[model samples]
Target: MASLAALLREAGHQVSGSDEGVYPPMSHFLADRGIPVQQGYHPRNLDPVPDLVVIGNALSRGNPEIEWVLNRRIPYTSFPEALKRFFLRGKVPVVVAGTHGKTTTTSMLSWGMEVAGLRPDFLIGGIAENFRSSYGKGGGDHFVVEGDEYDSAFFDKGPKFLHYLPYLAVIGNLEYDHADIYPDLESIKLQFRRLVHLIPTEGFLAVGGESPAALEACAGSLCARETFGLDPGCDWNADGIEMTEGRTCFDVTYRGKAFGRFRMQVVGHYNIRNALAATAVLHRLGVSARDIGRGLESFAGVRRRLQLRAEVGGIRIYEDFAHHPTAVSGTLETVRAAFRPERVWAVYEPRSATSRRNVFQLEIADALAKADCVAIPALFRPDKVPEGERLDLDRLVADLGRRGVAAWNLETVDAIIEKVVAEARPGDLVVLLSNGGFGGIYDKLPAALAGRTETTPGG
Candidate 1:
């Protein structure tokens, strides 16, 4: 939403918004753009009633502003609709969708297009480190968007991707997610089915051959389908994959022809998978293997995924958005493979709707157990999920302990920080995982770690 506001303001639109909790850096971003952001929604927030009321999916019928708009018979539409009508439309919308790696894949694709001289506009969920913003304007006919399966506004029950009108879609991978809206794996698959149905038969559906759900979603879609993964049957497969400290090397092969040996600045085998997905799309677009390698090397990655916060007393602090069980597991595996730190501390907040629910409690516990030490901060807004569905952190911690992981269930980030720093040693890697800000723990963790080291005796 902040990205949309910034983009609109850049395009000389009068953009104003009201949110229950207005916090930086979004609030500051709006202020810097000279846009008025009214904190806390009220019926009067829509007094001006200038244009359509862009309702966020988070907002419901009970919201005062929404009530006013409906009562007054004022115009209203979802954020996705606004984005499509105003930005996407006839543009070659390259949508990157999956349970994981959507942000990274989209950022990579966006950057690849830019490096290939497309100068494509993009709307990513997370701020791409290379772009320093989640959105931008493009002069070309392409627009790269991070396509999410989450539903649109409360008024629209369909997935957000339904409105984007994708010309080319990349299904990186898929797993059960958004437990709040989706009842089961098949329900989520149904949404993806709807998304793929929108693709033209002449267009392409680049899917991860390894993801069962992704394969099922592409089954009946008339779109030209191409699979990319480590599997032998895939149209594009990564060969000779290697992961080192700050760089990765791999060979991409398609239809018996060696595309090229590519290197990315990012770490992890999962990232290699993401690169393969991007390679499939770029290859379809006719981007040369040489250009793809250059783009991957120049890519700076998206924020909050293996983001290094600080290194104090030889202990490295990193932050990542790995709340889901699969994502957390993949991140831990990647971090373990790359850093091989003496000790790995995994701190997490079960804040996402799915993570907060009891859906994957045991799975999450096992994922965190892969680390040397696991600290789970108290679940945020647990009441959002009904009492019966809320995650049992106590049981989860016990399960982790049974798996030989030193696990602690702390109530706050400060407590988690103190606990982690008390045991952290040189060459250890502390990874903080959460989808939300977690009260800006990434910035605070480094400061606290630095302060503790300075106070400890070295003489």
Candidate 2:
């Protein structure tokens, strides 16, 4: 949203917005662009509404501004639709799509394009540290977008990527997610299939190897497809992958020829896969491997993934927006591979619509078991879910204990901090993961930890 605001402001348009709680990075970014934000939505926000209202997926039927727009019959469209009509159409749109790795891969590809002098227009979900913004409009002919499967709007009820009309699409990998809207794996597969069918024959579909879901999603599609991954069968495969000092170095070979050797400052073996996806897409678009290597090497990371919040007394703290089971598992795998600590503590909040429900209780427990110590904050607004469907905290704790993992259930963020302060020792790496800010636990933990110990104040 901030990126959109920045884009509009750069184009000399008056932009304003309303939100329940606007903070940081985004709030500061908006202010820097001279856009006024009305905190807490009100009907008056729509009184002097200008050209068109681009409703976010989070805004529902009961939102006061949305209701006012309906009452006054104001012209409106979803954010995706607005992008399609105004900015993306007629551009060389290279969309990075999948259940995960969308943000990191998109950022890598966009950074590579930028380094290669493409200066492509790009839209990513998370803020790329390289660009320091979620959206950028460059002077290049190509555009790179993080294609999301989330529904576009309350009324649209379709996958957000469908409207992107991608000239080139990357299927990084696929898995069942978003349990609220998608009933099963096949249901989610259908959306990817729809996205694949939208690609023109001249366009390329770079897919992941050894993923049944990706294979199934692309089955029978007419678009030209190229496979990339660690699988030897993939057209573009990574070999000699090595992680040192929280950085990944690997060699990517496409077909029989040597594509290039690449290294990323970011940690994770999964990141190597992300780099491969980005490299394959960029290479297909005429970006040389040398520029891709430079781009990947220079890349810092996305905003919320493995974000270093603070470090105090030799203890490191990180924040991640990893709510899904696969994402949580992958994050832990990366953290373990990157930072070999004396002890690693994981704090999780079951805040997402899917996580708050019982459907993923087992998966969540299994994923959290990867950490040395696990803590789950009580559901934020437990009443939002039905009585029977809400997460069972006791069961999660019991399951973790059965796996010989130390687990705690804290009802409040303060209590969780107290628990962490008591358990975490020096040289421990603390990772707090959630999709929403988890009541700003990232900031709260560092402050609480610093106060409890006789040491310097930091992470």
Candidate 3:
């Protein structure tokens, strides 16, 4: 939403917003762009009556500003709708859609286009380090967008991807997620199916061949399709993967022929698939392999996705925005592989609406068990979920213990940090997992670790 505001402001629109709570880097980003933002939402915030109101999905019908807009019958539109009307109407949009890897894939594609001198416009959910911003207004005809599966708004309950008329789409991988909005995996797949239907017959769909859900979602699409994954059956596949010294190198093959050898600063197999998805799209769009390789090598990656925060006394602390079981497992596996011989401590905060529920209880336990040690903080807002539906932390701990893994359900950030500092030794890797702020533990833990190191007697 901040990206949209920035773009709109660049396009010369008078835009102001109100929110319950705002924080950096978005708060600072908006302030830098001179976008006025009220501290909280209220009816009076709309007293001046702007020409149009853009509603975010987080705001419901009962929100003060939303109520005012409805009562007055003022012209209002959802974020996706506004983007469609103002930015994506005539452009060839490459919509990256999936439960995971959307932001990474979109960022890679955008950067690849830039490397190819396409100067493609892009809007991403996370800040891409290459561009140093989440949005860009380029002169090219293509626009790269991170197409989310979440509902559009109170007035529009459909998925946001529906609003993006994609000339090319990428379905990285799919699993059951967003339990609050989606009842089941089929419901989520149905939304992807709808998105696939929107692609023009002349366009193409790049899908993850290993994911049954992804293949199933694209089964009914009218457009041509290409599958990219580690599987040999995929049209685009990666082989000879090597991870060493915080880098990943692999060979990409298209239809049994070697396309090129690619190397990336990012780690993980899922990220490899993400690169493959982007490569497939760009290749289909006539980008040379040399440009794609250069783009992949130069891509700096997105913020908050397995980002290393600090290293103190040989103990490394990293942070990632992984709320689902698959994402958590992927992150832990990558860390374990990249930093060999170092024990990994997975500190997770079950803060997302779906993570707080029991829907993925077993999967969460299994995923966290991959680490050498696991610690879970109590749900951020326990009252949001009923007791019966809430995730059972005690059971999860017991289950991990039964599997010979050390696990704890520490309730507060202080307790978790204390446990980590006491148990973690030199050459240990600690990864913090959460979708929300996790009470700012990213900065707090590193400071605590530094204090611990200073107090330890070497003499």
Highest-TM-score candidate: 3
lDDT of 2 by residue, 322-360 (tens): 988889998887788778888878899998888889888
The CA lDDT of each predicted structure is 0.88, 0.86, 0.92
Question: How big is the positional error of residue 12 in model 1, measured in Å on the Cα after superposition?
Answer: 2.9
* Residue-wise C-alpha lDDT for candidate 1, range 1-459, written one tens digit per residue: 888778778888988888878888888878998888888988777767768778899988788888888888998898899899888987989889999999999999899988888899999999899989888787788989999999998989888998999889998888999999999999988888888999998888899999988999889889788898888678888879888778888888897688888899998878888888888888889888889899999999889989888888899988999999989999999888888899888988899999999999788887898898998888899878999999999999999888899999898888988887788889899888999989778888788888888889981
Clashing residue pairs in candidate 2, if any? 310-459, 311-459, 312-459
* Backbone Cα, N, C clashes tallied per candidate: 0, 3, 0
Mind sharing the TM-score for model 2? 0.95
What ranges in model 1 sit over 4 Å off? none
Worst 10 residues of 2 by lDDT: 450-459
Off by over 4 Å in 3: none
Model 3, range 1-459, lDDT digits (tens) per residue?
899999999999988998878988778989999998999989888869999999999988678888888889999999999999999988999999998999999999999999999999999999899998899988899999999999999879999999999989999999999988899999999999999999999999999999999899899989989999999999999999999646899999998999999999998998999999999999998999999999999989999988989999889999999989999999988888877747989999999989999999999998998898999888879998988989999999999999988999999999999999899999998999998899889999999999999999981
The residue pairs found clashing in candidate 3 are none
Give Cα distance to truth, residue 402, candidate 2, Å: 0.8
Q: Residue 447's C-alpha lDDT in candidate 1? A: 86
User: In model 3, what is the error at residue 265, expressed in angstroms?
Assistant: 0.7
TM-score of each: 0.98, 0.95, 0.98
Ranking by lDDT: 3, 1, 2
Give the winner by lDDT: 2 or 3: 3
